[model samples]
Target: MSDTTQAPAATGSTPASGRPAPRFPLPALIVMACTTFIGIVTETMPAGLLPQIAGGLRVSDGSAGQLVSAYAVGAVLGAIPAVMLTRGARRKPLLCLGLLGFLLANTATALAPDLPVALAVRFVAGAFSGLLWGMLAGYAIRITAPERAGRALAIAMTGIPLALAAGTPLGTWLGTTVGWRWAFAGTALFTAAILAGALIVVPDAPGQHAHTRIPLRKVLRIPGLATILAVVFGWLLAHNLLYTYIAPYLRQEHLDLTPDVALVIFGVAAIGGVWITGTLVDRMLRRLTLASLGLFIVAGVILLAAHGSTPLAILAIILWGLAFGGSATQLQTAAGAATGEHADAAISMVTTAFNLAIFAAGAVGAIIVDGVGAKSLPAVMTILAAVALIGVGFGRRAAFRTGR
Candidate 1:
């Protein structure tokens, strides 16, 4: 990509290299964060409002749940091509385009009269989300100085956990208290505000020089890229296995915790995780990755042994949140660093893997809930965490290399 560094005199931040750094770009970063927040809230708020949505759409709750799946499907389908085709577009304008699409889709979703229309608009919303996520990290990197890339990315990705911690819950409350349609309308309003911010506040960054863009096949061959994606897949699969069915998991005969209470605890802990990760990720990328994976294993084991102990279950949820909260920053940072100039392509793959895991978790968790039961989730999550941990451990030379 052609260099598009913001003015170094704005923020006056400095790197360890003793050079003047570009502006910190806090407004732009926050806009990006809010963009992610809207995307996630749009994608996930349906889960919490299924009963209302089903009633309004005149479908069974199971059918309403397919709205979420439709979004995931759109994301998995759109991420790669959307990114690849737009590799040469100016970053800020492309982002505005995505935000506009999201605004329209959410607005349509809020007014749809039937399940089919709602699902189609939801799919469109997801496609725009995939486009934004695929582009966000690379844009953050382009606008920041090289030495401060990790911190910049950490800031850009803060929206992910924040979406889980605050946005989705608020949307759910708004949906239930007012109407489910209002939740989506609120998202559309937020997107409009963000779109305006992108046009006015975010600096334009040039896309990759046409000659520099990598073909999909060659991008796939980037060393360590596959390994990092493997971790993304397995770790998220494990997380969603429990997260997607947390209500049922909490409702298990032995557990005393309510889903609301458990999620509150998890969300708070996840915010802490993001804080810790933002503080340390630039210096200890590999260590942080290892520690997060290890914590996931510990959380799963604790859940397995919790029996009827409410405290134990709470502890497990806290650990799980801490482990998962900063995952996008950690993995996306690694993927961007690993792919060098081709980070957009790799991050698109990360987006694809992320949505695929979300889709798979719903299906897999459903089967587990029906056959072996919700209690089996912790054990399944533990096995997957172990596998990801091992992948990170062995992938050090390429995927999770030290000396960040």
Candidate 2:
């Protein structure tokens, strides 16, 4: 769908020039990118439409927040099993099946009439989302040149920020203008397009290894794997604690912004951040990771100062978005580097940690918001950001020791 296609190379083959080798067909990359875009959009739409959904379903705002949490929980639980179950499956078929599952789950969300059903559907949607993302990362790496793997991954991940920047706003507008159901209906449509694109473009690619499958436990035992997981867990926990509650916090503060306006601002800032960070990640992975963590801390401080100032708060959020946009990519790269041969398992573990962070953040933010009021949002976020920074310090030490 996007006019981006680089020629594919042989799968799992080393570069002939003793450099990074290209692994998959260019068309397959495009298909995977499209699927990634739809996956992100489906995953994040609920964040933008929380208030409307809460009102429509007659649930507490906290209960409505569970829609986001449920998906994160499902993703945390689903990634490993999916990877293990489909260990040696062809990439194209797995991609197709994952997207198909996502399509069905989103459709279920669109048609659900009750809160429980909606939450359940969101969880299923999340499960599919995890499988799709995990597979995409591994598939991209397997199909691309070693030197180009970072760029390829960046290209694939571009879908996430694009979905956040463009898709979320569109979904929010649709939710406000039509109904929240239409937002999910839109996701289903996009997923269908991605599915079609995959069918038309992706070639049948073989598995990365014929007989070498790393056990999950062995994968987890990589030197810095546990530390990296801790760092990502902390980073995401802090980021989502603020992010998941942002829309509702802004509303409760009686800020002079509508839901659509806020969502647009968030989407734009997030995309800008992702674009900048994506490029940086391809070059200076570790340096950028440290820089992003610092920026996140600064964003939290700025948010604290901009507590009641709408324009200032918007500016702060944009910075926060930029910081967070690079976070997962940075951590994913770190995990891959740490577990050189077990890239698939490393990817799965990182995915799991990320989802768990989302679930933890949402649950914690809800309690904080209910007990402390919206004005306390920045302070809470600031504290979490500080914690993330501390984790980064540990990550830096671990990286230094491991020579990463």
Evaluated with TM-score, which candidate comes out highest? 1
Whole-model alpha-carbon lDDT for candidate 2:
0.73
- Give lDDT tens digits, candidate 1, residues 1-404: 11121223435666668876666788999899888888888888999999999999999999999998899889999999999999999999999999999999999999999999988888888888889999999999899776567777878888877888888899999999999999899899999999999999999999989989878989989999999999999999999999989888888846888887788788888888888887777667888899999998999999999987899999999999998888988899888878888999999999999988887898899999999999899999999999999998987777888653
- Compose the digit string of candidate 2's lDDT tens values, residues 265-379: 7667766666676565545666677678788778778777775688877777778877777666667767766666566677888888888887788678888888987667677
lDDT of each: 0.88, 0.73
Runs in model 2 with CA error above 4 Å? 1-30, 46-69, 112-120, 208-211, 251-255, 396-404
Q: Estimated TM-score per prediction? A: 0.94, 0.83
Work out candidate 2's RMSD over C-alphas.
5.2
- Report, for all candidates in order, the number of backbone clashes: 0, 7
Model 2: what TM-score?
A: 0.83
